[model samples]
Target chain A: MIKLEIKLMKNILGANDEIAALNRKLFAERGVVVMNLMGSPGSGKTTLLEKTLVRLVDKIKIAVIEGDLFTAKDAERIERAGVEVIQINTAGGCHLDAAMIQKACTSLDLNAIDLLIVENVGNLVCPAEFDIGENFKAVVLSITEGDDKPLKYPLIFKESEVTLLNKIDLLPFTNFDLRSAREDLITLHPTIKIFETSCTGGTGLEDWCTWLLQKVAR
Target chain B: MHEATLAENILNIALEAAKQNQAAKIFKIGLTLGEMAGVEVEALTLSFDVLKKNTPADGAELAIKRVPISAVCNKCGKIFQLESYNFFCPACDGILILQSGRELLVDFVDCE
Candidate 1:
């Protein structure tokens, strides 16, 4: 004898989204602007973040929640920049979901914090699928990466509110086709803002900073 | 790499449901995997096989339903499934933003 149950097949994402919504409400009430920074492992996410922290340390209180496979080095770098930082080692996990973020938030002082930057584990695929209760998703695509990245991984490009084309200083050296990259991304996401910057050279960084400040104001 | 974790989640959900319904054995479990879920079905199946050995769901059959890639046209506000990698709307050359292809769900269970 066997019984068949016809469940509605609710979205498995429901759990993660519910936690994300809660985090959003908490952020709104506390006037905190949370940014979900996503990119590949070597896309210069931490380097760009370090630059941002250097510029905004005097104006606004910032905190960082670093997600990694197995290291506290990034958290240490952020801590040395004179701000509160928490490191989440996913162990073998590919992405950081809202529940993990909620646990990390318990250690930070949300009252005094104006911005909370959650650096997701460096992976384009899984991170984009998980909602970590962020106001917006910011992606970093270094020029060193292939120009076909946007076409290969369309989800990250489509889901991102802002895309940072990092490592512009190396553009001259690499055979990266900028025109095709922009065209491919525009085909997927027309409204997404694209920024060209190099954390190493400090080129085209003001735009990213301005964008960050604007989001914090809202 | 994350197959072990995903398998654990699946087993947890199945066991909880089985306990609620007083099921002596689980017959089958249904899963919906989206196109862009970033999870490998083969790896998941392999993980389930190894992890379910001697467990409550030891003999349970796993059935997978794949979700197709879909997008919504920004200009026309129309949703359609993509048969290929092209992201442009066929009716119009408007950019199509992704609306699906990232689902991961455990839809139903068979118990006795």
Candidate 2:
């Protein structure tokens, strides 16, 4: 057998990207806006979703696709908020891929939904790399995670269009430098919209919901 | 992080390429990974080794070239290598837009 080199410059993430594009097309065709909510574990993504749904459900139709490593706990919480939700258990997978999101999208009624929030598996690194065909990628970083996180996980900060500085109510108890975090995040992504949020204290839910409403309206 | 999944995709792509070339065995696979690709080289290599077994692309060596992270200044448009992981322009102090840091691809395959 003769050794031969076949030049094939194919992207490794092509399959996932293709599927994500399909999802994006589907959402656009149905006049639905999708946001891929990403963050580290315990970044208060679920709580924020619950609070956002509570504020905006009466205004527009919203649904959720909850992603977790195991258990349907988050889906249950979203269900309690009176929103149609589907849980995707990756078992031990680090992040949710476009194929998984596409499968989850099947369970939802696309025509009835104005907005679809895909709560990605709570991971900072891997989740940032995969696009789930959402209109925007929003990341939540708690004050407790420290200000250096934007530098440590540049991809998440850079990829996201919005940053929810969650757990702001606990700012006084922790050494998290809110200013430095904001500066670093802005440096990484100059156009990124930021919000200081406290789910427990209900600090910035109103503004955040208002922003979401605007996106759905657009 | 998702290097294992990436390894699988690489293997499958290599297998397909080998078949297209009408080669019975894959010898080496050329992969290009960026610094900001969020993939560990060691982990991806290990995963590829484990998955290549019992496949048409068995015992294939992955020749991976890691591309360094770089960005272009949004204001001045000066491109520079991001050695310190800082996303700011040194010349104009402008916000640097990422140029080519986040890429993972199968460049080519050598087969027989």
Candidate 3:
């Protein structure tokens, strides 16, 4: 039997990157700033989105793409916040790929929106690997999850442009160390922007909203 | 799992390369996965086994190479391999800048 060798040094994620590039082009053409929000389950991703929506819905036109394994519950919550919402049920898929975002983009009124927030399926691991064509990735880590999370899951922290230390209101009750988390984040990513937020008490919503608005404007 | 999806992508890449080269069937596929790529090797192998049925790469052997994380020291300008998760430079104990770790690529494929 004759054998032939094909030396192809192609990236396995090349397909996803191609589609992500297309999505990025579409976002740029439509003048939309997309943010991919990722975190673990019960990391207050949805609540933070809800708070952001409540604050900026009147000032800026916004849309949301909520990703989950099952149910339209998060989408419903975002809908209640009075924003155009689309829910993608991955049906056991751990992360959202660029193709999903490409399909989702066709359904949104991109011309009427300034920002599109895609809440990734509450997974810190898989979601960080796939780029869904967002301007930048923002990772949410609750204070109750402990500060060692950054070292344990370095890929997510390294890939994210911003880190939201959520549930700060529970910090007094938990054994989480804020200083260690900050130092770890700084080590992993020297220039990562960090925000401390408490959705229930609304501690840093204004700063978060202002920072996001500046991003959308750009 | 994401491994299944990743396996599918790898199969697609192999098939596409085989077609471009006018090869009959793929015999071996080589992949490079970084230590910090967050992918489970056994799970990816299992997923490849299940998804390669009836395709050009049906019985192809997969060889995966794991690359350890490496970093360059920003302060001392020393490059070092990171055996552990600590990002400190071995020479000067400075915070090392990550050089390689997040790579997932199909290096080569053998076909007939």
Query: Which candidate achieves the best DockQ against the true structure?
Result: 2
Model 3, residue B78: displacement in angstroms?
4.8
For model 3, what is the C-alpha lDDT against the true structure? Answer: 0.91
Q: Which ten residues in a row have the lowest lDDT in candidate 1 chain B?
A: B1-10
Please give the RMSD of candidate 3 to the true structure.
2.2
lDDT of 1 by residue, A52-84 (tens): 999999988999999998989999988989989
lDDT of 1 at B22: 80
Docking class of 2: medium
Q: Write the per-residue lDDT of candidate 3 for residues B35-109, one digit (tens) a residue.
A: 999899999999999999999899898999988899898889988887766666667857788788878999999
Clashing pairs in 2: none
Residues B1-112 of candidate 2: C-alpha lDDT, one tens digit per residue: 6888899999988999998889998989999999888888899999999999998788789999989988888889899998866777889868888889788899999989
Candidate 3: stretches off by over 4 Å: B72-78, B84-97
Score residue B100 of candidate 2 by CA lDDT: 92
lDDT of each: 0.86, 0.90, 0.91
Compared with the real two-chain complex, what DockQ does model 2 have?
A: 0.76
Q: Measured by TM-score, how close is model 1 to the native structure?
A: 0.92
Ranking by lDDT: 3, 2, 1
* Angstrom error at residue A180, model 3: 1.8
Clash statistics: count for each candidate: 0, 0, 0
> Candidate 2 — which residues are off by over 4 angstroms?
none
* Rank list by TM-score: 2, 3, 1
Tell me which of candidates 1 and 2 scores higher on TM-score: 2
